[model samples]
Structures are given as structure tokens and as C-alpha cells.
Target: MTSVGTQEKTRPCPRCGAGIGGDERFTVWCAACDWNVDPEGPRKEPRRLDRTRRALARRHGEKLHAGIVSGEDLRARRDASALLALVIALAVHGVTAAVAALGIWCLVHGWGGWPMLPGLFLLLLAWVLRPRPASLPDHVPVLHRAAAPTLFALVDEVAEVAGTRGVDAIVIDGAVNASVQAYGMRGRRMLVLGMPYWEILTPQQRVALLGHELGHYGNGDVRHHTVLGSAYASLITWWYCFAPEDDPAATALELISNLLLLVPYWLVTGVLLLLDRLTLRASQRAEYLADRTSAHVGSTEAAVGLTDRMLVTDSVEAVLAREANRAALAGPSGYRAAGDRADELWERLTSHMASIPEAEYERQRRVGALRGHSVDATHPPTHLRRAGLIAGERMPAAVVVEGDRADRIAAELAGARRLVGRRIILDGPSFGG
Candidate 1:
């Protein structure tokens, strides 16, 4: 493969007659006109349910974006839909309580012979299906304020600007993404920073990322609330527990078990679908609100830059994968240890990102508009987000990370950067594209 800076062959794009440069062995396109930019058409979603959900999300996202463009308020409001979602969530929990009560009744009243066996089984099932509170994963590395004072101080400042509490912990991981999740029974917040994503962002864009994530805490998104979140989790578990096996039943007893579970399984599936539908608009709205908060805190330009960066995250993953593959193919003799390559890894990433043409970003935006491409099923289309930021009121950054402080934050992250860089060299990014 050819690196960006090297002299390579060039040809005019057939569609726009603009010069395209690259190694002949590799694909090249006119960045000026986006010719052949999305050579592969939109990916086929094989699952009928997934396709349906995507369609719904796209439709609702368009509506929400339209609303924003029309100068509708972005503040969270508990309208009928939100209230209904809460009611349904409570009803789901009620069902769980009923199951638990039944198990307790069985244990107390049916403590004899075969009845005792079924009673224990019911109790066990209830325990397994219980609503789970948020908790932090034990394995990932965590950063605290005392250890990374400069970075945490920046985060605290961003949190203050967003009108939310600062995170309880900061988790650094290798994925090409960032998120804020509520954990523990008390709902302490954790900000998960994906170093791959972080390394590519500009300083202001980094602040915007923080503003957007922290904004979730104040957004009142039903999907993130404990009652709804835990209930959704419980319903998922219930669905899996009762779902029929892929293989045909092996015996008469197995067949009976499947038959007995089919109705409840479908019931759980229906509830899951209903809950998702009910919360869909609210979740998307919350995301938009967060984006607005990002803009308010880091300035609209920075937030828009962050969104544009998101549009090309696929390229980021591809480049990282290539680096990892190169390392693997070279073996120990061909290259230094992964730790030694850390600085080089980031430098290459920064260069690659900087080398991307503005036309290429525009191409991505166009492709996103065509495909309704979003960060996931959860987020609005990236193009729409960029447009929304452009349309909304613009403001100067509420919190700025000046050059000296930016350097200090980078210095603090140096150790973490090395660890993540080594991991990526060994196993590639954990985002799985």
C-alpha cells in the first residue's frame, strides 16, 4: 500500500475530470467530486427486525432534525410519549415483581416432594431474571482526579458548563468511540474515553466530546434512567431465557419444554419491541440535546468538527487495522516492541487525519445523507447532526483548553496512550468497526 505523502500515479476521475492520486494497485477517487467515494452501496441488514428498526429510526430522526431546524425547543419535556414510556417501564417491573412473588409463595407453601423441586427452580429463575442495577466492569483501567488532575479538571469544567455533575471515574479503552455511562446503585457516572478517537480529535473537539457525553446526565433520556434501563435489561434476559433453541427438540420432553416456553418467549419479545418503540424518539432527542450542549460548551464549530470526524471513523478503524496488520506481518525482528511504537503510532494517526482532504469529508457527509448512516441504531445520522449544528445558534466556547493546558493534559495521558497504542499494535482496536 502507498502512504499519502509519497509520489504516486494520478488519473482524472471519469465522473468529474478531477485529478485523483494514489498507487495504481489501490483504489483512488476524486476527492473534489466524491466520484466512486461509496463504491460499495449501503450495507445489507439481513435481519428483518434490524432493517425495520433502522427504517423507523431514520424516519423519526428526520422528523426530529426537521423540528430542530424549525427552531423548536431542545429542552427535555415529559410529554405524553415519555410518560407512557415510564408507565410501560413500571408495568414491566411489575411483571417481574409478580414473578418473584410467585417464587416466594411456592417456596413457602409448596415445600414437599416434587413441589419442593419446582419451587426451588422457580426461585432460581426469579433470581436470574431479577432487574440488575448499573455496575462498573472490573477489568478495564480507570483514572481518578488525583491521578490525572489536569484532565479531570478540564472534564470538571466541561461538566460545569453542561450543567451536570463531573464523572466519578474515567475509563480509557482502545475503541474508536467515547461514552458516558451511569454505574453503581447510586448512579455514579463513568466517562469512557476511547484513545483512538481521542488522539484524532483537536483540542476543542476533545472538549466538545466531553460536553456531549456529560450532557447526557442532564438530558433526562428515558433510555438511560435506571427504571427503564434495568427493565430493558431484564426483558432481554427473559427473552433469552425462554427463547427456543436453534436445533430441533431432541426428545419428547425437550419438545414439551419448547412448547411450554414459546408463548412467554413471544410475550417477552413483544414487550421488548414495544419498549424500544416507546423510547426511540426520547433517546434520539436526548442525543440531539447532548450535541447542542457540546456546541454550547465547545463552540458550534468544534462540535461540527467532531461530527465530521465521526463521519470518517470508518477510515480511522481501517488505518488502525492496517497498522496492526503491518506490525503482525513484520514480526519481532522487523519491528521494535509495541511499546516503543506508541509515539510513532499516534504521529501516524495524526498525520493521516490531517492529510484527509476537505472534499473527502464532504463526500462522507453526502454518503451519510444517502445511507442515513448514524453512529449506530441509537444516534441520528452524522450529516443531519452536522447540519443541525450549523443551523442552530452559534456561541463561543464556554470552556477553552489553551496550548499550555492542552500539553499538560497530553502529558498526563502519555502513559495511557502508550498502553492503548501497544494494545492496538497487538490486537487492533476493540471497536470491531
Candidate 2:
């Protein structure tokens, strides 16, 4: 589902490429023109079970946090959590096997340690292979050789100023936008800034953007989203794999439990989607935290100043100009927007959307289909994102919008339903926590 009310980690506009922050969903418009923000949802309800069934929807990971995750503690926690999960998984497996063997084998014949042997090894392996916190490596790469130690050193430098640990990595994606893909137990798996994003903003503004992404990663927001999302995805796969094999007349109890395994992410996405404020909301909050981090690491003026400079559009335009370079490579009609087939597909999709109830879930599904994920994936449309920055531009309060701030952060988000390029929905809450 697309995000309506939710906040996103503020990135430069995917369309206009503006680097602004605020939460004004409906006010935002498509990057293509002055289209209204597409409302992305009528949230989807989880697939239902009989009245006798009992299962609560899974938690939508949307709670906002203040400040940031402390570096030392984060590292400790990552190691501990990974260790814990490994131990639990192995212990569960071992005890099951050992008890089964100890009972069944002894009853059937004499005692045997053969089966228990593997269990012992598993337990040992679990302890031995528990997750370890990854340290920033001392060596620098050729691409970063110019900066050398300074490259990663800068990460820590920024973090030190922010009162956090250094970031995970400094990726260089060809895209103009940047993202933080936190991994391990606690340490972040940052996509960091690409050269495009870097070139546009002044040094201070760049730091502000970095601080924002860091806020999300440090708060365990990234971990919560990814882990829960992975779990939910696993459940969906379980559902798809078993759907055909399960009895059509399955009992309600079985059905509910089975449904629990399959429907949580979509369901969670649906509810958060309907609420719609999580992305922009969470994102807004995260941006505020980053701002604080930047201010703490450096100065508040720099943080705010950085935000302003980052908003300048010329750089994003330059990055997108590269797309034109591939015009020759683009086939006749150069993509699917113009053809009769594309038109027919669009009509069919809109027709299908029209049939659904006016709710956040439905809107999100429609948006997801267009975005090319699942028919109900939990993401907002790209076009809507372009509009949000512009929406802030329109709001007088937007100029001094405060996020992660103790101050008012401009506008509160519009009611959760967001719209864009024929898709209106919310970005779903992070799947798991």
C-alpha cells in the first residue's frame, strides 16, 4: 500500500529531485506537472477467518523515536540479538530432537547417543557462529583512495559530532537518490550518498541528509522494518507454497493460524496504509532527528542551512539528464507509456481499482501494482514523492519545518490516503518490528 499519512526518510525528489522535508500528503503533486497528490489508499483488511478464529494483526512498525541509537550500545546490541536468535533457533531444534530421541528410542530399544550427537553439534555451532558486530575496516578502497582513512574517518567524524558511531558503508549507486539498508544485528547497512546527491548539496546540507538517514538506522527503525518485513515475506511465501495443498474445507482454527502465517505483512501494511501517516510521519520525525544529530555534531545553523541548500534543484536535473543519453537505447516509443497495449493495461488497472472499496488497502494495492512490486506491496509511488517536496514549498510553514525537533514540524500529514500517477495509497509501515 502507498503511504498517505506516514513519513518517508527524506530523499531528494525522484521527479523534481528536490531535497525538502515536511508532511503534507495531499498537497504534494506529481513531478510531471502540478497534479494533486494522488491518494494512495483505502487500506486493505487482512484476509478474514470465521467468527470463531482468534488472531490479532501483526504490529505495524511505525513508532517514532527521538535522538539516535548510541554507537557503542548499538554494536553491543547487534551482537547480542544475533547471538540470541541463533541460540533460540538452535536450542529449539536440539531440544525437540533430543527429547524425541531420548523418549522414542529408549522406549523402542536401548539408549543411544547417535541422534543426540548432531544436536550437540548444532548447539555448539549456534554459540560459535552467533552474530558479531562488524567494525569499520581500517583499509580503504581504490574508489575511496583519494579520501583514504579520511573516507571512513569522515563517517566517524560526523558520527562523533552527532554522538553516534560511524556509518556502515559509503556506496556509490548510479541513482541520484540514496537509502540506508541497515543490516547485521545493530550496525547499519547504509546505501549512503551517491555522487549525484553529494554533488548537489553544500557540505553542511549533505551532513543534514546524512543525519536524517542515520536517525532511522540508529533508532533501530531500519532493523525493525527489515526483520519484520523479512519474516512477513517468509510467511507469505509459506502461504503461497502451501495454498494448493491445504484442504479447501480446513477448520476455522487451522485457517486462522495459517492465515496468520501468510497475511500479516499485507494486513499490517493495510492498517498503517489506511492510517497513512507512517512514512511521511516517520520520515519527518527521522529528518528531525538527523537535524538534531547534525546540529549536535556541528551547529544547528549548518543543519538547517544544509537542508536549504540541498533543496536546490539544478543537480537533480543534471542527474536526470543522463537518462536522455540513453534515448538511442530506448526502443521505438522508448518505453511503455505511449502504446495501445500500455493504454489498455492502464485502463484495466484503473477499472480494477474502481471496483475496490474506497479504502487505504485498496489504494496501496493499486499503487504497488503500478510500482511493479506485489499487487499489494507496501510502498508509496515515486511520483507522489516528487509532489511532497513541492507541497512543502507551497506551505509557508514549510520553510522552517521542524522534524525530530522539539518544535512544530510545519504541517501535520494529510489524512493517510495519498495519490500519484493513477495510484493513490500509503507506503506500508515497516512489516516487522
Best by TM-score: 1
Residues 1-433 of candidate 2 have per-residue lDDT tens digits of 3334456345465567665333333134343332222454334444442110111111111122211221111111233434444344344345435544554544345336565565555445444333334333332111232333444554555555444566556544323444565445664554435433444444445555565555555644422354333433333342343342267888888777677655644553443332222233333343434444555443455454444433322224332343333222455544333232323322333333333222323233234334322111332222222222322212111112124421211011111011111111111111110
The Cα local distance difference test for each model comes to: 0.82, 0.37
Q: How many residue pairs clash in each candidate?
A: 0, 50
Give me the runs in candidate 2 sitting further than 4 Å from their true place: 1-147, 183-191, 217-229, 232-287, 305-323, 326-433
The TM-score that candidate 1 achieves is 0.88
By summed lDDT, the worst window of 10 consecutive residues in model 2 runs over: 409-418
Alpha carbon lDDT at 321, candidate 1: 84
Q: What is the lDDT of candidate 2?
A: 0.37
lDDT for each residue of candidate 1 in 322-425, tens digit (9 for 90 to 100) = 88888889898425677788778889988888877665677777789889998876677778888899999987899999979999998888888888888888
C-alpha RMSD of each candidate structure in angstroms? 3.3, 16.3
- The list of candidate 1 runs beyond 4 A from truth reads 1-35, 242-262, 330-336
